[model samples]
Target: MSSAEDLQFKILQHPNPTSPEKRVELMANPTFGRVATDHMVMIRYTEGKGWHDAQVMPRGPLSLDPSAAVLHYAQEIFEGLKAFRTKDDGIAIFRPDANARRFRSSAERMAMPQLPESLFVRAVDELVKADRDWVPSGENASLYIRPFMFANDAFLGVKPASEYMFLVIAAPVGAYFSAGAVTVWVSETYTRAAPGGTGAAKCGGNYAASLLAQAEAKHHGCDQVVFLDAVHHRFVEEMGGMNIFFVFEDGSIRTPPLTGTILPGITRESLLTIAKEKGIKAHEEPYTIDQWLEDARSGRLTEVFACGTAAAVSPIGAVRTKDGEVKIGDGTGAGPVTASLKESLIAAQRGQANDHHHWVHRVL
Candidate 1:
């Protein structure tokens, strides 16, 4: 077993890093998660040994055993956040401490060993700082950072693996779902999570399960899929990739509550806070899909949007169901409240506006 004294990070400089000009060209229009940075952060974990051999090494393929427990049992979880080039030419991350807490919660849900909150944050900070240049400088451009943990023990039995690895990788990216308001397909046939499932966890399996539903959305010529609650199949839980928000003509806002069946997204929480500060009434109660359809159809619900790390604040132009489709706010590009909130959020993230919550962490 390794001691806490051995948890120090060993930094290794990449021998053949991408050139600055070429990197800039790549960042000009880099698709999400396709382009990688020069270096990454990795930490090893053994049940009795605790966490040891923390390193900042060159980004490359992982050499995992084919029989690794994560491969068979899917005992893995991940978190997503971004590093932005602030207005003062600095690099910062948004509310990573919140992400750390969520990561711990997910690790617990996945039955994997916990990576300390401090270690997780430090690993992310190290990688982002190492690849600071990858943080693009433009509207809607930033370095998307992903931190993940998985079982590393090469065993096939259905049990928790004693060996594990935590890694943080960065990629320069633009918008995740495209540039404008998106149309979502209501997934009545597929459910994202049950009452006591890992719906709250940011695990790969949850996403893997949603891919088919997402594919179905694409088949319907929709941009994303919105999932209903598992038990009743009534309430709006979240979009396949992000949290759903409903804005009313009365200027009130409501999002689905975190009832262990939906992800407690940091962006969703931030928007709620921002709405309150702006004097907009906001609530986190269960709102059904029928209610959404009725409100939109009756001119009560004025706008709908999805919030997350990748898509930021995206307006939902319309929703497609088995019955038909209805456009929100006359199928506009972006409504006033949506545009205002998105601008304010992005501005705060980029240091253009005040950091009310102190969520931004400066890395470089």
Candidate 2:
């Protein structure tokens, strides 16, 4: 196996790139995860050969054996981040290093070989550079990047596969949700993850398990679903795809703690750091659903929001449960604290504010 520094990416131009006029048409009203770029990056891995055959090639279908391990055992992991068109007319990816670290952590949990963080980051950088034109420039618009890995071994045994594939593909996207605040549905039927489960890992199975609950949320007329802890099913865990936070009248905020049952969201972490910098008194503690309702009804809870790579600081306008609905902050829109944190995070991501932590990685 070679050092991470020794791995070189082979760049291949797409023979049939999207025409500029069509690209403009696509970017004009890009929806979430709908409009894809022309090229993608791929890297192959084998137990004996390590990681090799890296290429930035045309975006297309993949060839997997019928008995591939990933198809049977669900040994797959993935990550999502965005490339922002900066205020200074450049391109930057927010916290690729953090995403890289999480990717390795997810691979370890899935009993798969870990790719070097440098290689993971370099692959994303290569793809973003190749499709820089796809990075949209506007409010709440950026190129959403997806980096994923899957077991490719043809063996169907109940063990870790020796061969794997890593890939990065990007899409130009607008806001994940429609304008204004979003309503949430709390699920009592399905739980996302239990203790010592894959809840902390960014793997596909975790999401596969939450699909039904998400559908239930849609059935109940809500924008998203919230899951509770598996044991008591009382304490709030996280939303289907994002982390939840609560704002109070005392100018303090609280979010559910990470006890191996919730995904440690990058956007959530950034908001916490920004809150601390602004002296907002943030606490990563557990809050129960009953307490959430009480706080909302008593006017103690000022605002609630969900944060993640895809959603990006969305305010929770109301909470819907079996009993009834609890409106958050008049059920209108983002409160002051939620709005301020989002502004700070977005400014830093787009290189319009002081990047005190150097979170943004410049690519162009």
The estimated TM-scores of all candidates read 0.98, 0.99
**How well does candidate 2 match the true structure in TM-score terms?**
0.99
Instruction: Tell me the RMSD of model 1 versus the true structure.
Output: 1.2
TM-score of 1: 0.98
For model 2, state the Cα shift of residue 235 in Å: 0.3
Model 1 pairs whose backbones collide: none
Alpha-carbon local distance difference test for all models = 0.90, 0.95
The residue-by-residue lDDT of candidate 2 on 34-150, one tens digit each, is 898999999999888889899999999999899999999999999999999987789999999999999999999999989889989999999999999999998989999999999
Q: Tell me how far the alpha carbon of residue 306 in candidate 1 is from the true structure, in angstroms, after superposition.
A: 0.6
Tell me model 2's lDDT, rounded to 2 decimals.
0.95
Candidate topping TM-score: 2
Regions of model 1 farther than 4 Å from truth = 1-6
How badly does each model clash, as a count of residue pairs?
A: 0, 0
In model 2, state the lDDT of residue 249: 100
